[model samples]
Target: MRSQKLYTSFGILIIFIAIFFLKQNFLGEKYQDEHHYLPTAVFFSKEPIPSLDLLKSYGELNTPVPFILGGWVVSVFGENIQCLRLLTFAVSFALLMIFVWGSPDHSKRFFLCLAGLMIFPNYYLCSVYYYTDIFAMIGVLAGVVAYIRKAHGWGMLFFIGAVASRQYMLAFPAAIVAYECLELLKKGFSVKQFFTGLLTDKTWLPYALAVLSIVPWVLLWKGPAPAAVMTMQYYDSDKLIQYNFGYVIYSSACLAVYYIIPEVLITRNLRYFIDFPKNHPRLFIGYIILIGALITLFPAKQAYNPYFTWPYLGYVDQLFMTIGITGFFKQIVFGLLMLITMMRFFSPYFNLTSCVVLINILLLGKAQLSWDKYSLPMIMVLWFLAMFDNHWLFTASNRKQDKLFYH
Candidate 1:
């Protein structure tokens, strides 16, 4: 049975890779962040790192590792656009392998999680685009998996790589530290014990290394200039808070519609939401109503649509964008759900893996832009978290065994 399941997963992976290559060929052009990174890659191909002038001009807009990798590929492969994209595809395939390898063996959840990841629109789009997000995510996912498996040295190494891929990935190591601190507290360790653990525990090495990894980048970065300062001035804290909150809710809603709903429908896994109407029917019905209203009232056209545009998919883009509203009632409902999910962070059943997942979500929510690519890591984390048997938030008792199997 295990052999058959593994074979099936391998077959699915092969099919997914084929489809990804087909999409890349069909799309046939670069857009958005690809433009930014490609130029950097070309420069790096010649220079191998940004000069002081380049750093001062670009002002830490792009990080090093992805561009470095792209440079190597371009050097060997003769500067072909497809070659750079092929590198991204290779990195993405490695990411998929890591997820599969880290997943619980002989479990149907492995297949389901892989399916969720492949079918996610952003993951599909990012897989084809020549960008650094996937490369950074490769390190993030590997680091999280290593931490979960208690491989501290490997986790720290991947975390460093992740930081090198993108500066924003510093959130990941910070999340790890937070998780460890919370764990110590849960174990009834005193302040002295906590400090002692930090000094003594091998697991704590990752946290320290995570801090050290930033030093080189800090020394190299030339810092943002006057224009960047002006840009920051445009979005004040009030506006940023509003934008961030709306993005968090809207992105979560999109995740439900694009990924979660489809998964439930295809698998007939109503058990995934067994607690929804059962535990709070009014809240459940209200959420359903809000979703329906959002769909109905969504604008057909928008001035600022950041979504990937495929042929004949403009309406779908508008539909998803409709969730990007910041009305009082919408905020109230979304805030409620956010609160519930946040509460799960304090649950004793919530393990290190769950803590990491929740922390990533929280940090990503604060990001200014609401791109689908930004949410891909969260989707993968959700898939991995689903593999665990414990119900972090919904468990009736600590000792209760209420596993939600995919099959």
Candidate 2:
């Protein structure tokens, strides 16, 4: 990471490879849902200044920001989806550069972080399409970069853009708010002291602004998201509150597959299985009891999941089912793996990345649907934290915790 040669050369190689397969079926578009969004973007292109009525529909449960921006680009370059996808690839590439440069130092770990992101199924792999996720993630990664630099205003601005790009993006800013609030509680363990601490700092302003950016949408839609596509996801704008406790467990299992599985593969000590019980006996017992209760109550493949036909359980569950694991057995496997995932990464050293992951998971639990790509932001933050070697999960046991990881 110190020298640009390796980084630049790798990026070039990737672009060259993508170009080689640009016209082939290697990266097929069967699952990609550009039809849902391209029309909305086209609408934005023709009507650069959309009216209030137009804003009401708001492009298949999306905010107007990305479509408007995408429309502007498409108008200038013609509606070549391939060209637009190239632009998305460039945006993802820019995010990679930001992560590499915005890291506290240019350690080899920074390069590792870049490599991890490039290979992620949801990151660079999805960049060769005319989708809006790449736009949202840049806002997220850039905001995290601002957090690293302690630039409150920049973080707020970036997060505001993120929220406009995708409503779920509120999680990043909200995590900062939660982390700051928790840090304030650490200063004085009282309600009055915590409230005073919150008011006493300029750190919360940016996140506050970013979170509040959703207020107008909430008011207009009369719910968290647009009503135009609510029914498709088995929701009603009139009554958006659907209490599905099962989703929390299902999403945890997905997190285990996406973040925990990769990390465990990297650090294959086998001590996770052996020492977890020995190190934290009571927690282990409680984990077993809790897993038993949860599996009985809220297993995977929920009735409320609109994507029941879709492989929303993620890769691990799909693999299990493919290999003759299904029903109660699959849920039990998810329960056990999820506990290991939660305990391993978020134990004694819960920091910024931990805050991001927990908050995102909790928020997703309430979402109308869940997918592996929803975990992309969390995975990205984990990689960033890994770059700085900031927590116990990243082999930072001997090193002192970095100040950037506080709370």
- Give the distance in Å from residue 294's predicted Cα in candidate 2 to where it truly belongs: 2.0
State the C-alpha lDDT per candidate.
0.61, 0.70
Q: For model 1, where is the 10-residue window of minimal lDDT?
A: 299-308
Query: Which digits, one per residue and each the tens of the lDDT, describe model 2 over residues 1-407?
Result: 45674566577568746764764623345334776566677777777777777777764676668788777777887765665666676777777767766776555555556666667776655676767787888998899888777888899999989888889899989988877776676566688877777788859778988999999888987776667577665666533565555666777777777666666566554555566677667877887898788889877664435434565466555678899889898888888877876675565445566677778877877766666677787788777767665432332443233122221
Candidate 1: tens digits of C-alpha lDDT, residues 1-407: 45755686588578766876677553466676676677767767776565665543442244678877888887777667778887887788889878777776655566677778887767766777787888888998898788778888888999899877876676677767876776677778888997888778657667658757877655754231223522443422344343243454545544555555665666665553564456445655665675455434541122132333332222233443376643455444444444334332333345554555556555655554455556677677667766655432233452322233343
Model 2 spans with C-alpha error above 4 angstroms: 4-31, 237-239, 269-273, 302-312, 389-407
Q: After superposition, how far is residue 179 of candidate 1 from its true place, in Å?
A: 2.1
Pairs that clash in candidate 1 = none
Identify the runs in model 1 with alpha carbons over 4 angstroms from their true place: 1-9, 24-27, 49-60, 215-219, 222-243, 251-317, 320-348, 389-396, 399-407
Best by TM-score: 2
